[model samples]
Each structure stands twice: as C-alpha cells, then as structure tokens.
Target: MSKRSESFLRSRELAVAFKASIPVMMGYSVLGFSFGLLAVSQGLTWQWPVLMSLLIYAGALQFLAVGMLRAKAGLFDLFVAAIFVNIRQAFYGLSLLRPFRKTGSLKPYLIFALTDETYALMTTRKIDPRLKRRWVLFYLAALNQSYWVGGTVAGVLFGSTVHFDTRGIDFALTALFVVLAMEQYKAKRKLLPFLLGAGASLIAMVSVPADRMLITAIVLALLGMFALRKRIEDV
Candidate 1:
C-alpha cells in the first residue's frame, strides 16, 4: 500500500481502539485518581503514586499497597500480597493466549498491560475488519494505561495542594468492578459463573476475616468452577 494509505489505516485502527477504550478511560480515570489521592493522603510521597501507576498499574493492589507502604512491609511480604491480589490475571492471560500468540514483540507489553478493564474491552468488543487486530489491541492497552497514569498525576497534584475528606473514595474501585461484571453478564448471559462467584463470596465472608476474605473467595470460586467445568461447558 502507499504511504498515505498506510497512514490512513493506522489512524483508523487507533481511532477504533480509542473509541472502544472510552469506557475504561472513564472508569480508570476516577479510580486511579482515588488511588493517587489515597496514597498521598497516607503519607506517601507524590512520586510513589505516580511510579506505582506507571509501573505496577494494578489498581486494587496499589490501593492495598498504600497501607503496606505505611507499615514498612518487607519485600517478601509485598511479593506474596501481589501474587495473591493478582492471581486472577493468570486466568485472564490463559483466555488470551490464542489472540496474543501473533502479537510478536508487542506480546510482553500487552501481557504486562492486561488490566481487568483492558481484558474486558479486548474480549468483548469486536474488532473492525478493516483495522489490524494487533495494532488495535496495542492502542487499547496503551490508551487505557495512559488514562490511568494521567489520572494518577492529576490526583497527586491536587492532593498535594488541597486537603479534603477522602472517605468512601475507595468505593470507586468496587463500583468499577460491579459495572464490568454487569457488562460481562449482559454479553455472555451466563448466570452460572455469577452464581458460583456469589456463593463463594458469601461462604468466604462468613468463614474468613475480612482481610482474608477476598483470596478465600477467589480460591473457592476457582475450585467451584473447576468442579463444575463440564456443566459450565455444556451451558
């Protein structure tokens, strides 16, 4: 193709990817801003929130890390917590193996950037046939992260200057998850997964301390899904 045609195709791919990522941008901007504001409020330097958002990019874990940082947690403790908090990403990666196989040099960055919102957008949104899939994926991941990082920076700047009550701000993350879950249910119309997850969460909440509840629920849900794999497949 001519240079003009190639440029046009690239722009089209980026436009489509940006449009698809708009929802995540809305969600991440608010959550990431909350994280940054919370991190700074907890006595962390402005650099910590910006660095974590740029490098770690794990929303929930970054929230958890604020306390860990305040407590001066050991590296090993952070490592373990990170693993427990992000174990779900392993499952997300499994589902994307085929689509990512041909991503070439971009594979590593794509894998690193596969946040929950990114995964949802990638799996649920259909790609434009005229645009290259790999480029679209790359643009989506990049754009989402940019929104997060931008929000983090904005929060850090604002928090450093203005003091206000941040109570209940963390609910933004939970609200984002609920929205994503609803979107997934709408797309798949799969009640079994939701039922199993709710059952696991209820059991874990009753049996474990709040600190341990999330991991317990995740483990139980994984086991429940595995046990019911055949049934799930049929459904």
Candidate 2:
C-alpha cells in the first residue's frame, strides 16, 4: 500500500478498535476513577494514579498498591504480592503466545497492555478478519490504555472536590466479578468450570494464609482443570 493508503487503513483499524473497546472504555474509566478517588482519599498525589495507570496498568493490583503505599510496604513484600496476584496472567500469556509473536513491534506493547478486558476482546477475535490482526491488536491495546490513563487523570483532578458517600463501595468490586461470572456462564452455559474454581478457592481460603490464598486457589484450579480437561471437553 502507498503511504496515503497505509495511513487510511491504519485509521480504519483504529476506528474499529475503538468501537470494539467501547465496553472496556466504560469499564476502565469507572474502575480507574475509583482507584484515583481511593488513592487521593488516602492523601496520595495525583501523579501516583497517572504514573501507576500509565506504567503498571493493572487495575486490581493498583487498588491494593494504594494500601501498600499507605503502609509503606517493602520492596520484597510488594514483589511477592504482585507475583501471587498476577500469576494468572501467565496462563493468559501462554494462550496468546502465537498471536503476540506475530505482532512485530507491537508484540511488546500488546503483552504489556494485555489487561483482562483487552485479552478477552483480542482472544474472542470479534474484529473484522480483513483488518490486519497485528494492527487491530495494537490499536486495541493503545486505545484501552489511553482510556484508563484519561480516567485516572480525571479522578485525580476531581476526586478532592467531589466527596462520595460510598459506604459500601468495597462490595462494588465483588458485584463486578459476579456480573463477569454470570456473563461467562451465560455465554458458554457451563457451570462446572466456575464451580471447580469456587471449590479450589474455598479450599485455599481454609488451608492457606489469607495473603497466599488467591494464588494457591488459582494453582489448584489450574491443576484441577488439567486433570479434568478430557471430561470438561466432553461438555
């Protein structure tokens, strides 16, 4: 393609990516805002939210980081907690190894920007097949990150002025998970998978330290899935 043609195609790809990422735009904006609000409420600088979202881009972990910052968590402690929390991304990365490998310069950014929402959209392959897959992935990652960064900036700017009477704000995260689970079950209509995950989590909660339970649960669940892979496929 000529220069003009290439530019047009790139724009088109970005437009499609923006449309596809609308749901995530809405979600990340709210989630990012909440994080910013929480951080500023704890007397953290606005720069912290912007920097965290720009560099780290892990929503849930950033929320936890707020508490860690308040408590002055040590480097080793932060490292361990991050490993335990984000270990599941290993599975996500492994699954998308092929697609990401083909993305050339975008490969690094795609890996870095593979938030849960971006992973879901990319793996689902909902974008037009005619669009270059690598470009599509690139735009999606870029646009999603932009949305989050914007949201964090907004929250930090306005968080101090707007006080929310959010007494039960903590439950909102749980509600979002329940909604995601229901959406998955609705899409696939499979109960056993969620049940197995829940079982593993419950076992870990009872057997492991609170700080360690999440990773243990995920490990146990992955093992259970591997053992039952054959039967689960029968579904």
Candidate 3:
C-alpha cells in the first residue's frame, strides 16, 4: 500500500478504537474519580491517586492499596495483596494470547493496560479485519488508561477543594462491574459460570472474614470453574 493509504488506515483504526472505548471511558472516569476522591478522603494525598492511576492502573487493587498504604503495610504484604487482587487478569491474559502475539514491543504496554473494561471491549466487540489489529488493540488500551488517569487527576483536584458527602461514590466501581457482567452474560448467554461464581462468593462470605472474602471467593470460583471446565466448554 501507498504511504498515504497506510496513514489513512492507521487513522481509521485509531478512530474505531476510540469510538469502541467510549463506554469504558465513561465507566472508568466515574470509577477512577471515585477512587481519587476516596483516597484523598482517607488521608492520602493527591499524588498517590495520580501516581497509582498512571502506574498501577488496576481499579480494585488501587482502591485496596489506599487502605494498605494508610495502614503502613509492608512491601511483601502489598505484593501478596496485589497478586491476589489481580489474579483474574492472569486469566484475562490467556484469552488474548493470539491477538497479542504480533504486538511486538507493544506487548508489554498492552499487557499492563489490560484492565477489565479494555478486555471486555476487545473480546466482545467485532472489529473490521481490514484495520491493523495490533494498532487497534494498542489504541484501545491506551485510550482507556488515559480516560482513567484523567479522571483520577480530576477527582483529586475536586476532592482537594470540595467537601461534600462521598459516602456512596465507591459504588461506581461495583456498578461498572455489574454492567460488564450483564454485557458478558448477554453476549455469551451462559448461566453455569455465573451460577458457580455467585455460589463461590456466597460460600466465601460465610466461611471467611470480610477482609479475606474477596480472595477466597476468587480462589473458590476459579477452582469450581476448572473442575467443571469440560461441562462449561460443552455448553
């Protein structure tokens, strides 16, 4: 192809990626804003939120880090917690192996930027094959992170100045998860995985302390899914 044609195609891919990422943009902005506001409210400075959003970029883990930081948690503890919280991303990465194989130097950044929303968009949306797949994926990941970081910065600025009730702001993250889960269910039309997940969570909640419930639930769900993998795949 001619240079002009290549440039135009690249731009088209970027535009498509940005458009597809708009839903995540909306969700991340609100959720990141909530993280920033909550972090500051809990006595963390604006810098922590901005830095974590830019570097860590894991929504749930970042929120958890706020309390860990406040409690003066050690590096080993933080590392363990981060692993447990983001273990699901390891599973997310498995699904994207083929798509990311040709990403070259972009592979590391792509992996780093694979938040739940980005993964959902990539796996669920049908992209035009004519577009450069790697570039499209790269743009989608980059654009989503930019939205999150921008929201975190805005939230910190807002929280630093204003002082209203931030009581229910954290619900934004949970709401986003619900929407994503609903979208996944609609797309896959599968019930077994959802049922197993809910059952594991309930079991974990009853068996474990509140502080350990999330990790326990995730472990239980993964084990259940693995044990029933043959049935799930058949369905």
Candidate 4:
C-alpha cells in the first residue's frame, strides 16, 4: 500500500479502537481523577497520581496505594497489596493467550496494559474485519491509558483548588467495577465466574482480614475452577 493510504488506514483503525474504548475512557477518567484527588488528600504531591496512573495504571491498586503510602507501608505490605489487588489478572492473561497471539511485537505491552476495563473491552467488543486485530488491541490499550493519564493529570492540577468532602469518593471504584461486571455479563451471559468469585470471597473473608481477603479469594476461586474445569470449559 502507498504511504498515504497506509496512514489513512492506520488512522481509521485507531478511530475504531478509540470508539470501542469510549466506555473505558469515561470510567477511567472519573476513577483516575478520584485517585488523584485521594492521593493528594493524603498530603502527597499531585505528581503522585499522575505518575501512578501513567506507570501503574491499575485502578484498584492505585487506590490501595493511596492508603498504603499514607500509612508508610513496608516492602512486604506493598508486595502483598499488589498480589491481592492484581491476582485476578492471572486468569485474564490466561484467557487472552490465544486472542493476543497475533499481536506480535506489541503483545508484551498489550499484556502489560491488561487492566480490568481494557480486558473486558477487548474480550467483549467486536472487531471490524478490515481493521488489524493487533493494531486495534494496541490502540485500545494505549488510548485507555491516555485517558487515565489525562484524568490523573487534570486531577492533580485541580485537586488542590477543590476543597469539599471526599467522604465517599472510594465508592467510585466499586461503581466502576459494577459497570464492568454488567458489561461482561451482557457479553457472555455466564454466571458461574461471578458465583465462584462471590462464594470464594465469602469463604475467604471468614478466615482472613479484609486486607488479605481478595488474595485468598482469588486462590480459592482458582482452585474451585480447576476442580470444575470440565463444567467451566463447557460453559
């Protein structure tokens, strides 16, 4: 293809990816801003949120980081926090191994950018036949990160000026999750995963502190899926 035509096609593919990633843009912007707000409220500089979103980009973990940073958490605390907050990502990568095979040199970054929102969008959103799958996936991940970074920077720039109650700001994370869960359910119509997660969480909470609950729940949920592998795969 001619250079002009190649550029045009690439732009079109990027547009489609951006369009598909709109929901994530909305979710991440708000949540990332909230993270920025919370991080600054903890007496850290606005740079904290901007850096966190740009580098870390994981919503829940960033939220957790705010508290951890405030409390002066040690290396072990940080390590455990990361594992608990990101454990479910293990399953996400496993499921995407086949779909992401074609992403080639971009595969490493794609996997690294596999936030929960991005994962849901890639797994559930239909791709246009004419657009290259690898490019679309790459752009979706890139655009989502951009939105988060924009939001965080905006928050950091504006967080100091605003001085109102952030008493319930953390709820925004839960709300974002509810939205993602609804989208996934609509896409797959499967309840087994949700049921397993809830069951394992309930069981885990009974045995561990709230901080350790998610990691334990993920472990139990994985084991449960393994025991019911046939049923899970068939579904």
TM-score of each prediction: 0.76, 0.76, 0.75, 0.75
List, residue by residue over 1-235, the lDDT tens digit for candidate 3.
9999999999999999999999888878887888888889888888888999998899888887776676776787678789877888898689899999998999999999998789998898888989889999999999999999999898899999999887766666677679989999999988999999999999998998666666678778889999999999889
Residue 70: error of model 3 in Å?
2.9
In model 2, which range of ten residues has the least summed lDDT?
165-174
Name the lDDT value of residue 54 in candidate 4.
Answer: 74
Stretches off by above 4 angstroms in model 2 are 126-130, 163-170, 178-235
Clashing pairs in 3: none
lDDT of each: 0.87, 0.82, 0.87, 0.83
lDDT of 3: 0.87
lDDT-wise, the better of 1 and 2 is: 1
Model 2, 169-223: lDDT tens digits are: 5456667779988998999887788989999999999998766565678778889
Candidate 4 lDDT, 105-142, residue by residue in tens: 99989988998779888889898888788888999999
What's model 1's overall lDDT? 0.87
Better of 3 and 4 by lDDT: 3
Cα-based lDDT at residue 124, candidate 3: 89
- What TM-score, to 2 decimals, does candidate 4 have? 0.75
Model 3 TM-score relative to the real fold: 0.75
Looking at model 1, report the run of 10 residues with the lowest lDDT sum.
209-218
